[model samples]
Target: MGSLSRHWPRIAVTLIPLVFALLHATGALHLGVLQRLDDIIYDARLRATMPRTLDERIVIVDIDEKSLDEIGHWPWGRNRVAEMVDELFDRQQASVLGFDVVFAEADESSGLKRLRQLAQAELKDQPGFVERLNQMQASLDYDALLAKSLQKRPVVLGYYFTGETQAKGVLPAPVMRRSELQGRPIRFIGWSGYGANIEQLATQAPMAGFFNPVVDSDGVLRAIPLLSEYKGEYYEALSLAMYRLLVGLPEVAPGFPREKFFGSRSYGGLESVLLRHPKGTVAIPVDDKVSSLVPFRGAGGVSGGSYRYVSAADVIGRRLPPGSLKDKIILVGTTAQGLLDLRATPVGEAYPGVEAHANVISGLLDGKVLFRPDYAVGYDAVVLLLAGLTLAFTLPLLSATRAVLASAAVIAALVSLNVYLYSAEGLVLPLAAALVMCITAFALNMSYGYFVESRSKRELANLFGTYVPPELVDEMVKDPEAYSMKAANKELTVMFCDMRGFTKMSERMEPTQLQELLNAVFNRLTDIISSNRGTIDKYMGDCVMAFWGAPVDIPHHAPLAVKAAIEMAGAVRQINEEHRAKGIPEIGIGIGLNTGTMCVGDMGSENRRAYTVIGDAVNLGSRLEGLSKAYGVEIVASETTRKQAPDFAWQELDRVRVKGKEQAVAIYRPLAPAAGLERPLLDELKAWGAFLRAYRAQDWEQSDVLMLNLQRMNAKKYLYELYSERVASMRLLPFDPEWDGATNFETK
Candidate 1:
């Protein structure tokens, strides 16, 4: 049986995978149940982990070909642009400015173009003399004044980085290097692009960021490259430059964890962003491109929202607010019809390309991005260990019904807990493994109970000859192992009850009438038993047998059994009252209860079986029911039951060894008095107990005293003389100390 019970748990464990697969195939379980809720939680979590705001920002002053065509031709002459910058700094007091454009060649104004021709002619016949004379002349540097103007103030220039192997254009020097992140040396590859600024002017800007948008597999710009090292030095992106200016954090903290040069975080090889401060170093979370998730407050869609397009024409014209450009870092990008600066982002397909930088700057300022690490094995191991160990202990002691219920509850609890940790605690523990364990146990146990164990229960029921309660057979089917033939000592509440003079009722009634009447009374009693979750052991002809705290360890089984008894007596009384009104014969039943340790299990032969309890308690319960008539009450219980059930209302009836025995036992009736007796009859029962106690102690004076009062109060009461006679006899020789409530049986 031990082996079988162990196997029962395995049966539940084995079949779950099959059921889960079936459910999965049908699409019954999915995250869609709470997709909206999960989104909100994840979004809020991501929002709280990014930077607060942007600083030292440079606004791109777009000198699009449109402004060029409106003024004149392609090169709008460095003189005009130089004049604009001079007015911006001197009059408007603009703190900083950056150009998204570059100049690789020297500016050739109309005057210089004419001077070169005249110089070449001066040495026309002189051969090498023409080159010598032309070189000697001081050629006009058109952008020279513009370079000086930009150099005197703070300005940052735009540059880019690439991995084209063969350089496509000019590349910038590295600012973020491998030594800063990795303990080892680093290597980088880059491309060359056209630079339009004059070399002297390019040196004027203090910092710069390569404006290269990194897109993920879905073609969304979710993250950006914060650092990309080349050879041994790392360079910063436009967003990073702005962040450093904002926070004033040292580029490198004193001691920091070094990652390998190849790949450190989820942002591919160069995705991680490490910044140093007094407290500790903080890693800005990014995807493969060292970019963070964009927080789009609205659906900016394919066409990005309008930026605060501050016109350069207005600022130079003094057509702006007084302190608008005083201390602000402005990015000047084009919104003119043809110049495109838009790209797709996670929240918007057509987000402004420059807005990606703005979003990153916002993230760094707001601190709302979440980072998932590459090394998350520790969290997974903990979850797996907890789930596996808990299931091991939980599956063994539980029956099929309880096991399945607990498994469902555990799975739901784990899911809720994990979701909370993920959202609130920033924890990313394994959810799959624990979920699998719960689903596996429930699916296996239920399928086994329904298909396998239930069939056994029906068979066990079929084998129990005249076992009475057929539902016990069904209950056994749910967990046949719970009904094993081997018995263990268990404290139980046993109830034995029988209909009074059922044989006499069979005499006058026709067979059909008897069947109908028995069915009605039996149905009422069965209702009471099941309503209180008590097991009906069987029905012996017109008698009902039941026991509690078996098959299932109900903590309050005693109370439940007592409650069922009280209810059963009331139901029978209600039926009797209806019968009396209809001029039918009244019926009555006697109920007895006892609580003690006993052995309960399957009994009888292989071909026939019985699920019943047996012990001295069982015999006593039957005796008490038989003595109920002598005590003139419907329900009687032993003192053992009355003690454990002190919360219930009870009336003591007698100390009697009924019919065929010596020794005595105290018997009491649970008087739901309105249900079992008339108001006067209850007074008579109390008066009777008063008389019986005296009789047992040989107090004839007290017994006779109570008998005289009882006869006066109610002459219709029965059993007074029975106790009076016993009192007379006990007084002659007295009872022995070895006496108990033992009744000698004349017949089996």
Candidate 2:
């Protein structure tokens, strides 16, 4: 509760960005940043996943520089173009021919009108000149010759529409009329002007399509309009027209999503274009703009090699093999750099504009067109709502490691699903919005946790900086609401260490020197305890109290306490050496450790609370610290501690009742880690065990003999000497069989 109360502002801050992103995705708000990001990601994905293989069905008849050098530069005379068309249809056997070039104006390059004027005016009296002009007139009319070649042929001429005011030349027969869609409220892109074929060619080849390419705001040609409106009539793109021609020129109609009968509503937005044939129907996908994404085959130009390119010069000269373009849809386009027909696309920066139309045509034929319908906005919104809110609320509750894993899992799943849809279903769904939302939500949440929530935690660390180990403080702050100062009973390992000769040593030193000495000693001892993961409870004069398994839980608190006790005893040796060199009396410390259930937490008046432990187990720890003198050892621990940490070598001290507890707890002095104990130490332990066993069995004679041998083995060992004297005194007294061999302590 405390942590939550303090850090709720950070949690709320993390959610604010998510809400704004949701609003933007759902169209309620217009922050345009996410949309731009989505556009870039979509472009990259499209480029990366393009099928780089060639499509053999469609071929490009390119008027490249090589062709230009061989057959003269572009805006070629109508007579030569007439020959090229005848060569492709007559010699190469192309099934269908479409021009990417526009022939809007009349072809007067042959200058046939000037000769006729001379025959009529200046050479009127010349009989041969007038007759020759009259005879050669039809042969000199190149436009008439080209029109004658286009007559009754499967040649689709290309033209262009503009946004300007006036419509120029003539347009082909309308594929769809405005009267058909009059009452449906269909929104079509309206164009004002157009550049169409000359009247002769338009009348001869009535089948034509506008070759106007729709470039995006970024100047990239990603989509081509399948249908556009001009002067109350609808015309098809070159790709759509060519596709219709290939499929037997089916009737094209506007398609909408299947919906239940609702009176007089716009059929939402254009979903697809339906082609109705006698045999069956084929639905070509398109977006609301009536545009379809250009499925790029590869990078650019000849390197893409999506379609076979044939030189116009070769075809015009009939230098190619027979049936080389047999039954193939041939599109006549220029790849000359000066033609300015190159366009920018997702796949390439300078992509040929004609190839962009070719890609769309091929995609429509194969049913591999990528569709991004109006409903994609709704899909993006749903993903943001589900994924964004999930991360926003849940990430703050997780640890740093867990939060990272969670974010990674979400991102991986989202990307995998998106890529799968792209590969399998041909759906160009909006991936950028969902992806950006997830990333931003996670980033914002993590930053808030670090900059905002962590500030409170750092403050908590400073508050308890000197009282506990830094690691403990860190763990406690992870869930500060659950950690309270209220008293609670927990199984903990507590330690109490008191300087044995500190009072006598301090009496001889001045107050200033004694203070310095005490500070140095406490500093060294406290470091040992903290380094071993124990929390210091308090310090009184020369005595220091510490514990483990509170503020943070250590499953093996007993072992940690025992390890700290050993290290502290070793530190005293170093302390004493320094003191002896400084001409001051050296002191020793006795440490006692007991592992059991005890009450631990902050306990005191409201103004002076201290985080400490209190219970019978704690009292026993203090009593054991005092008994270290009686055992002639520096450290003593209850049997419970020895049992929990069996990896350490322990020597039995005695079974005695302490000042507070009634149960006669057995105590032992921990020596060293059991792995490093010498064989002599093991043998001595065995002998001591035997002596204690006999002493408990009332075999005084056997016990006396064992004790004497143990005394000889360690003649200066006071613990053994004390036991020997006790055994002798016990022999003089009457023994009771009911005795449990427990010595009772009568004083504190």
Candidate 3:
């Protein structure tokens, strides 16, 4: 609970994108950019996966520029079109033939109507002219000739639906009636008017279909409605008609989803269009509008090579060998630019509209049509939920590198799943929401971590950076909430290091020189203190105060403080050596260390605040520094500090009562690490220990013997000499039973 409260801000920022994504998925908000990106993704996937190889089963008889130039312009005399149809059926042996062009009006290029008018008015007196016109009418009526050629043949005529209410010519029989839908409220592409074949040709080829494609908002013709409604009748597309003719003209019916899978409620759409034949039923999947995405084979046009292109002039002029198009499904359409048959498609911007129909026909025969099922919206919601929530909760907890990798993996999984459905199951599912949500979540999470959370860290660094080592600051920033300036009681080690003989050095040197020298000396001592993870409390003129285990916790703080004091003393020694080389006055430092419970935090007046420690232990530490001069040692440590640092060898200086305290406390001076103690020092320490025991026991003779031996070992050592004089003074007095052997200091 505490951790969550601490990191709530970061987690909330990570969820911002997720909230927007959920709104988009649930239709509460619409993101047009995501839609556009989805379209691009779908187009690219379609283009990349298209089969560019030739489909020989479907062929396009292109009415290109060559055909127009060789056989005059389009809407050529119906007699010429009749002759071309005869050549394809009688000579080429095509199994099924369909026209992508509509014969909406009668062909009058034979001049038979003008001749009839002349016989009626201008040449009424010429009886022989009227009779000759009647005889040639049968041969000149081009519409009749084309109708005769189309009869009793496997032919499917093409037409188009329009949004305008003015119908022209006559529409063919609808594949399905409104009564067949059983009031399911399926939404079919609706049209109010149409341009179909004239009655004369319609009777000959009554079976026909509309070729109206569904253009997307981006003006790309990627799908075609297999069934469009006009006056309560559902008509089929040209591609669907051709496929039906090739498969024995199966009966069409509405295909509803099974109730077990989609529940009993209305799905608001048709699942598929079923083609029922004697053998089996073929199901063609449809989207909400009863449309199917055209599976483009590849780029379009004659040079595209996805479908074989035969020029109409060649077939009409008998340029190809007979039976060459045997068993091939031929579609007659124009690819000439003047015909305005080019369309924008996924694979090509200027794709032949005829090739789109051809590709649909090919896909229908192979059962590879793509569609979005009714549950696609639900699928999108589920995906977005999973992806968004996963990133929202997990990204805030992960490191930067892991978060990036996790976000990448989620995006890859979404893309792979979407592509697999498209390729293997022919399902066109929504992916943009999930992908955008993941990327946005990761970016937002990282940004918040860097900007907002890092601002908190920077503030922490600014507050305590000067008082503690940068390494300790780094540790503190990892969980900045865990640290603060609020005062709290904690067991810590405090240090007070005072420079000795600073007054004498100041008197002998220039003010600037003295300042420079002091700064140099303090800089060295501060470095030593910081290197050992000590938090410097303050510097009081000739003294520097530091501690361990505040703002950040250190379990072995006592040892660290002791270690830093020893190093500080050594630094002062080195500085004094440099002073000696330069003929400057030598200096010294006295360090005191104590470990106990103290109040540690940012403390002081509002105008001048500092992160420092205060308590009895801190005061005792200061008094220990003063006692270091009396003991003639560079470092002094309280008994509590000595007890914590067992690895260091210590010499007990005295048990003394300072000015403020009535209770006496034991103090010791650190010599060196226990492992590094020399044989002579160890022997002297042994002798000094015996002297302390004898002096405390008031055995003057024994104390004298031990002190003489200690002085002989190190005659010039001040601590041994001071203890000798103390024992002499005490020996002159009577052996008093009330004496506790604790020395007292009247002043600090």
Candidate 4:
């Protein structure tokens, strides 16, 4: 709870971007840049995953430049169109044919209308002219010939819808009427004007569809409306019409969402268009706008190789073998540039508009059309919430490197899920908002941590950097509010180390040389103390003081302090070796460790304050350091420190009363780690223990015998020799029953 409270400001900063993302997702605020980025992402994904292989089921009979050159300009004579239609169905045996062009006016290229005017007025006086014209009428009437050729054929005529209010030509029967919806308002793409086939061709070919595609705000054609509204009647697109005709003309009905996930009145748009047949029902998914994303197979045009492009002149000229295109669905469209049929698509700019229809028809046949579900907005909101909150809460707690890695992982997951849905499930969900939200949240979090929260850490580092180790200072800065320099008593382990021979060395050596040697020695010793997690208190003349379990609570401070003292003794021995090689004076150090309650914090006069410790335990530790030289040992520790640190072996020094204290305390010299003690040392300590017992009991004869054995074990040992002298002197004194087994010292 404290950690959360400390980092709440950072969490709030990270959530700033999430609010904007949610607004953009829910339509409260629209971000045009995000939408444009989404379009670019969709385009790149489509191009990368498109099946760039040939589709043999459908073929495009392109009226190319070659055909236009061979047959003259566009809007060729209707007799020629009739001939082409006859060749496609009768000669080539194609199963279905769809025209991507509209015939809005009657064909007058054959001069039939001019001849009729002449026969009615100017040429009325001519006798054989009228009779000859009547006989040639059947062949000259190209519109009638073309209409007759289209009769009873499996042909789907294409038309276009416009936003203008002008309507022209005739429209085929709508696939669905508004009454069929039962008055439920469905928001369909509505158009006010249309250009359809002529009445003559409409009557011959009753099946027709509009070829209008749904253009995005960026002017890219990515989807086509399967059903649009005109005068309260719903019409189908060219692709949908062709697909229905292929499927035996199933009944079209609106498919509503099965689960009202957003409530009844939330959405009234059709979820899909159901093709109801006796066998079963085939549902084609649509977006809220009743549009499906065009599943482009590959690039368009002759060299694209997605669909076989046959020149119209080849079919009309009978240059190929008959029945070569037998049972193949053919789309009659012009690919000539002058015909103006190009459109900008996701896969390519200047894409042939006719090929767009062909791609849609191909997708419809394979049931692989992609769509944005009506719940896509809800999905976006949920994903943004999850990712945003995850980053907002987690990034503040993690380090900079970890935060970056976490954010990258989140983005990769979102992209992977989105791509899987697009490729495997044919779902086009919104991804831009979620992606932007994650990135922005991470950036905001990192910025806040670096700029705002770093101030507190810097202040903490400045306050504690000198007295504590860098690592401890780093740890304290994570929660700087929990620590302060106010004086407090704590159960701490205090250490006092004093140097020997400093006065003699300073008297003989130059002042600069003595200062350099002192600094070098202190530097090496202080490193060992800091490495062992000790906080340096202060440095007195020829002495250094330190303690543990302060500013940061450490449960094992006694063991750490004891270990540091041991290492510091070893460091002095090494320094003596260097002094011997340099022909300089050698030095010695004595360290004392005691564990007890002590006051530790910044304490001094108002002018100059120092973070130090002061209490009875601290004084006892200093007194123990002075006793190290008397006991002929490098390190001395109180009974309390030895009890707290059981990992090391100790040789009992003495129980003595110091100058300031009346109570006697037992002190021991740390030998080595208990596990590393040698057999010889162990036997010697056993013998020494027996000698102390006998000497304290006034057993003079037994003490002398044990002393001889201890002398033989280590003859040059100062401690055992000193005990032997004491035993010899005390032998003459009478034994006092009131005497306690402790030594007393009255001097400072």
RMSD of 1: 33.5
For model 1, residues 504-589, the per-residue Cα lDDT tens digits are 87898898998899888988888788767666788888998888877666677777778889888888889889988987787888
lDDT of 3 by residue, 1-748 (tens): 5666677787788778878877886679999888888888899999899989999998899899999999999888889889889999999999899999999988888899899899999998986999888889999999999999999999999999999987878888889999999988888989989999999999999889898899997889989999999999999999999999989889999999755332323476788999999999999989989999999998899999899999999999999999999989999998899999899998888899989999889999888989888777677877887887778777777889999999999899899999998999998888887887888788778877453367877898998888888999888887788988999999999988898788998888899988998898888888888899988888889889999988789989988888888878877788778888989888877888899999988788979998889999999999999989898999889999999998899999989998789999999998778876899989888888888889889999999998889889988999888888888888899989888779999888
Regions of model 3 farther than 4 Å from truth: 1-5, 259-266, 452-748
Query: What residue pairs are clashing in model 3?
Result: none
Q: What local distance difference test score does each model get?
A: 0.60, 0.84, 0.88, 0.89
Residue by residue across 634-704, what tens digits does model 4's lDDT show?
99899999999888888888888987998888899888889869999999999988887887788989999
Q: Rank the candidates by lDDT, best first.
A: 4, 3, 2, 1
* Best model per lDDT: 4
- Runs of candidate 1 with Cα error greater than 4 angstroms are 1-146, 166-173, 179-198, 246-249, 253-255, 258-318, 334-340, 366-369, 374-377, 380-748
User: On a 0 to 100 scale, what is the lDDT of residue 425 in model 1?
Assistant: 41
Could you tally the backbone clashes for each prediction?
A: 53, 0, 0, 0
lDDT, residue 39, model 1? 42
lDDT value for model 4? 0.89
Taking all chains together, each candidate's TM-score versus the true structure is: 0.42, 0.59, 0.60, 0.60
Q: How does model 2 fare in lDDT?
A: 0.84
